[model samples]
Target: MKINKLLILAALPMIGLTANAQDKGPQKNDFTVAATVSYNNTVMQNAAVGTLPSYNGFQAQSTNWNDKSLQVGIEGGWFFLDEWKLVLGGGMSITKHPGYSGVPGSADSDESFEWGDVPSYGAVADQNFVQFNVYTGVDRYFKTKVDGLYLYAGARVGYAYGRNISFTDDEYNMGKSVGEAFNVRGALTGGVEYYITDGLFVGAQVDPFAYTYNRSLIKPQEGLSNLDANSHNYSILAAPTIKIGFKF
Candidate 1:
């Protein structure tokens, strides 16, 4: 009888563990990692206005912090509570614009290009951009009626650095045009995730909207003076991204 009682006591703990393992809910100390990426060739609408003047050789240009065409990111989070997570992540973005024709032989004075008013004398004009960002945030998750489905909302704040370069035809002998920009950004994020199986999930997320403050310094060619500009802007932006995540 004592042997049977011992066996039952040992099995009780295993039975409890099995029951706990079957519960597929977020728990304290659970860690998760996820990836987000997107690609599109479409031009951005409502790009930030440039600090430099629009000229034949120099087009008005600025960083569009919300542009997502060229983006790749990875994030990881720790569940401090069953319903709340602390997350950290970073991303990179890039854009390219090509083939701008400048006015013929209009820029004759040094001051013309300095104020960004010089007419272009080159046949080839283009601009390219790249940006990097890192962020941290907290997310709150809520369980729905359906099993393995959770809805989440969060807020994030991050810093971004962006670089843009304008190119003119070599024959024009114009100075290089480059703009270096920085942004302080914040956004609200929300998403729905459906766990395909325990510890694995697929979901979609979007920022819904965001605000950014931008500062840009323009070097409009080696000879011309540098320009400083700042802007405060709010944009209605929703960039939806698919996600795959694992929890342990």
Candidate 2:
């Protein structure tokens, strides 16, 4: 069911591609609105478990860990001048481990295991992670001389919040805390868009460079106060983005 939903979302940009081509793309005073979708799969390596509980079960003999997510976003832009646009947008992402069982050698097994298979597999509930962000930016399009094609570049600043909540047990006896993070980020983005018609187009973009400041908080146990962690990071962030939209 989930895979089907993701497949549908991924195919959105292809819907209007067969429309009649427009003689020109966006011009001054034109407005653009778009929806973006993205997916990410990240492989995680071993990490130090400093000062944390050394519980066994799922954590024992860990072999692999992966983080996966699907995101949806919307944006609106105003062509304030020829070849220049002012944009504002926001997005939300949901992360889940549909097939991963935090145990060694079980991640790729075709056999499905139930919670009863492992007595200490309380961590199975650690499947949901969610994030949201909003941003404002400017974009520039360089004429390519080729009809229906344009090169794009942009810069944006955004604020984001994310949380991962899990349980020590399925019941409320050992309530879990939310692992939460707040981030302020900036990025330089570039892409290409081709107008299928005067008002419709599809494009792909990437954040080749980005900077972020993050503050994370988590509680060790049900009744405990949160512990704080802060960090500054710079990297090429995010997966390739797919966008579909209309300009008028």
Candidate 3:
């Protein structure tokens, strides 16, 4: 009888442990890593207005676009708290612009000039840009009705360095540094994710506001020498991204 009672006591503890494990539910995942690709058609734009001494009372306006910028990056996060995560990421971007042609002349005048008019003179006639950025942020995830669906809000601070080079010909080696900039920015981010499987998911995110300070360095050109290398310029911008991730 005593041996049977001892066996009962041992089995009772095992049963209690199983019941406790069931009541606690499945373990939550605490870490995630992701890769993202983003595109921005109008990352930057600028317009300039001026008057030329040769054209009496004439005003000229010029516009520029930094179109079709592409970025690829990776991000990783640790959920230190139940619903809060610490995130870090880094990326590189490339932007290209169409080649520039000299301003068209009036139909009445036969005098027209190309950008390569002067010997040994070069203009950033066609530009290509490359940039790198790194950031750290905090994210909060919310519970949702559907299993494997997640939503998050985050904020990040980052620094970026970029350069734009102009090439004289199709060979990119014949190029000169036309412009460069260093920037620091802070952003507010929000996103949604849906996990197709327990460990993999797809998502999209947007930065509604990014406050930035930019310091620019640009080469001098004919008739336009007003660029300041030590100026403090501020801008507000937004960025959107699509990503795929894995959680473990």
Candidate 4:
């Protein structure tokens, strides 16, 4: 079921690529399908867990929070009504930050594991998300040329779906309150996009914040007092992109 949903999101861009070509008309009504490439450094983002326990009996804390990460994706759109375009697209992203060394065994939690799988396995005590975006929004253009660059801005909303979060046995018992997954997540996103050309764009977007709803989450863990003490959040992000596209 999860794989199918992901496939649907990943294949959305093709709808625009198959549209019939519009002759001259307003040109804005033309559709576009461009392969895009983008890279961004997540220099800073802050999260706060509820509060940490004075006891050192358990292994707890969110993974490295300030580490840098990278994202690359492809996006395309269909302009059905000249000025209004429905953008349905998706891409993949990876985090550069490696997680804690291993799932140290303990009396309360007996889970054990190797350290190398931290990032890829996502099976340890770490907080990270991996997913893509398929958004739809209205774009209004005001400029001089059909293919030339134009400045524009608009609202976008989409559904975010992924298994992006998981847990290892060693990560159990450390929940702010109780019954929190190694990671828990759901998708929600909104942001803006700009056109450098009818087929190219530069955009910045963010997913809605994730909520653990655990009391302990409201309470800080050792390394992540900022999380519960403040808030531990992960998001589905698609941004700081320089993607070139084309109309079919």
Ranking by lDDT: 1, 2, 3, 4
Question: TM-scores for all candidates?
Answer: 0.60, 0.57, 0.52, 0.38
Q: Which is superior by TM-score, 3 or 4?
A: 3
TM-score of 4: 0.38
CA lDDT of 83 in candidate 1? 92
lDDT of the candidates, in the order given: 0.70, 0.66, 0.59, 0.40
Q: For candidate 2, lDDT tens digit of each residue in 1-248?
A: 99999988887666445333435688999999998886432212122122354333222111111133665667899999989999998767787744223334333333665554543332344446787777899999987877789898989887767777655443422345456667677889898998877899899988788776767666556666666666666767455789999999
When sorted by TM-score, best at the front, the candidate numbers are 1, 2, 3, 4
- Candidate 4 lDDT by residue in tens digits, 1-248: 99999998887766444332212222555776655444322121212222334534333233222232455555667777765666666544444333353433333322444454342222234445443335455555444354343444454544332222322233433432221213222333344444543344554444344232111222233344422222244544433345455555
Clashes of 2: 0
Best by lDDT: 1
**Candidate 3, residue 101: how far the Cα is off, in Å:** 27
135 Cα displacement, candidate 1 (Å)? 1.6
Pairs in steric clash, model 3: none
In the range 1-248, model 1's lDDT, one tens digit per residue, is 99999999999999987666457667799998988664221222122222335543332223354544555568799999989999897767788888556465455665555555546554555677887777799999999887778899999887767787776655544535777767677889898888776788888887778776767666667677667667775755455678788989
> How many clashes in each structure?
0, 0, 0, 20
Q: Which stretches of candidate 1 lie over 4 Å from their true place?
A: 1-22, 38-67, 92-131, 164-178, 221-224
Model 4: worst 10 consecutive residues (lDDT sum): 41-50
